[model samples]
Target: MQETPFCLRVGHLLPYSMSDSNTTDFTNPSNFILIGIPGLEIAHVWISIAFCTMYAIAILGNFTILFIVKIEPSLHEPMYYFLCMLAVSDLALSTSTLPKTLSIFWFNSREIDFSACLTQMYFIHCFSAMESGIFVAMALDRYVAICDPLRHSTILTNHVVAKISLAVVLRGCVLVLPTAFLARQWPYCRTNIIPHTYCEHIAVVKLACNDTRVSSYYGLFVVFFVTGLDMLFIAVSYTQILRAIFSLPTKDTRLKTFGTCGSHLCVILAFYIPGLFSFLMQLFGHNVALHFHVLMANIYLLVPPMLNPIIYGVRTRQIRDRLLRLFPHKRI
Candidate 1:
């Protein structure tokens, strides 16, 4: 006998009426059931506790970054401007899904309206793309500051930074807008049960009855074209930065030059490594457990937002000093 489709196996979970013979289709499904993680439902409460903690940290850390950057005159430079953009993007990205995810885990409120799912999908992807673009901008700032110090200020002027910020935001919005439209057009006849915590692009597409090669391929293209291109640019920027740092006359000069890039490199790695791993696993790791895949997806979304401010606070002298000054009496 053929295996039961994943959606039908979880059909009882949906509050919607099912077809009499289990052969009818739910063309649009109107709404979807998001089962937080398959094969680990028993552990969801425990998982929610950890996820809730991370969500709180992400909120507080990113807000603190924004607050400090806004109030501190010393952090008004191009680098910190990019940092502010990063904090904003992180805030939006995490906020896009965490509340709903927590609701599913905490209250068993797993049903999401179709339109709401699409909106969540759009924001999640748009901010993700925006964050990648911001990383590219931050990389360029570091490159100019270290590799071409004299021209850094003139090149990355206030006007230029503003323009770059606008471009990043527009690029993300335009690129991800298409995916949502494409997803909306799909006929989700395969039942409305999404096996993951959130409405990920491929996961939603997988629920469609018709051919979704175009949707899948387009999503992959966006990732490879926009995100891949951004990574390429960041890699080149760091290459030049390293070469410039090594060429400095004194050891102390080299160390100082390299120090400026340390936090950025760490943040980039923290964001991209898990991102790429999850992407590849979704593509090729058919043998991998479904819960593992979903868990990795959640981790990729949560970890960077939680860690970025901490990494910057510990790695940057100015931010660290300012943070200490803010909490002078307490040991933070």
Candidate 2:
């Protein structure tokens, strides 16, 4: 009988085996679970299919949004400029995790290199921050258009829009880079199996053997500082916008103004509400809650991107007109 290889024997013990020819087993036992979710094998296949579809749609939808904004001279205003930024951010956000996630599903391999994992996490945070900033900018743009229409063009001139874009990029860099730096300092003694489909900062941080208290605190601070503050500003802006709209002499003007903002409000709520619920579920409920949290995570990340173009096209006449013009023969 031929002797069994030591590497093969070792690989059997690890949750995930290295793909390299050297055959070194880099498996951490603590990270191994017995695939605890019932019917997880079938669930994995379904999840893979679902994620692949979502990933493809996300890429295509965002790309179309970007293309429309770029080619259409009519969309050169600050609002469309910021819409393009949001599209870019959404593309980056989805791309950061979906490809790798699809690979794991198809290949039955979850062995991501340390550096690759870190890179994915960094971009995930960065693009998410960027999207939040873009939403805030959108609210501000609406405020100016409604509350200070006389100076809308002056206040949000090309130069000013460019400056705001630069500021959003800079803020994303500053806020998200620290997460990568802090994550790198910790030793990943625990199992490297990330539970979720993506390289989420919180999920990965939970696997660190070292103290992640600081990282968690920083993440919370970011969530509160960026999301919390942005939401507050958006609320105030919308409140003032509502007051202005109601005070308008013509009902048509009021309705048009509300129509313009309605889609954005819907998208914002869709993106934030599921995410917040998932976060709360994860924090409060440990066992069964995790499963629901994971499901919500997928919806939160994918649904907004999928719905954004539809929402804007359906809600805004200009966007609908452009879409129709782009496909002139197609009937609505």
Instruction: Give the alpha-carbon lDDT of every model.
Output: 0.88, 0.73
lDDT tens readout by residue for model 1, 1-332 = 32344452311222333344333566887788898888788899999999999989989998988998888998999999999999999999999999999999889998999999999999999999999999999999999999888999899999999999999999999999999999999787756778889999888888787788888889999999888999999999999999988888999988987888999999999999999999999878877878898999999999999999989989999998888888769558
Q: Tens-digit lDDT track for model 2 on 1-332? A: 32222211111222333233323234333332212112244577777777778778777877877787778888889998998888888777777767766666676565676767778889877887788888899999999998999999999999999999999999988998988889888766424555566667787777666668899899888888888888898899999999999999999988887888898898788778877887676666555534455577767777777777667767867767877788668558
**lDDT at position 10, candidate 2:** 11
In lDDT terms, how accurate is model 1?
0.88
Runs with alpha carbons beyond 4 Å of true place in candidate 2: 1-39, 330-332
- Report the lDDT of model 2 for residue 137: 92
Candidate 2 lDDT for residue 243 = 96
Model 2 C-alpha lDDT versus the unseen true structure:
0.73
Q: Give candidate 1 misplaced runs (Cα > 4 Å).
A: 1-4, 7-23, 330-332
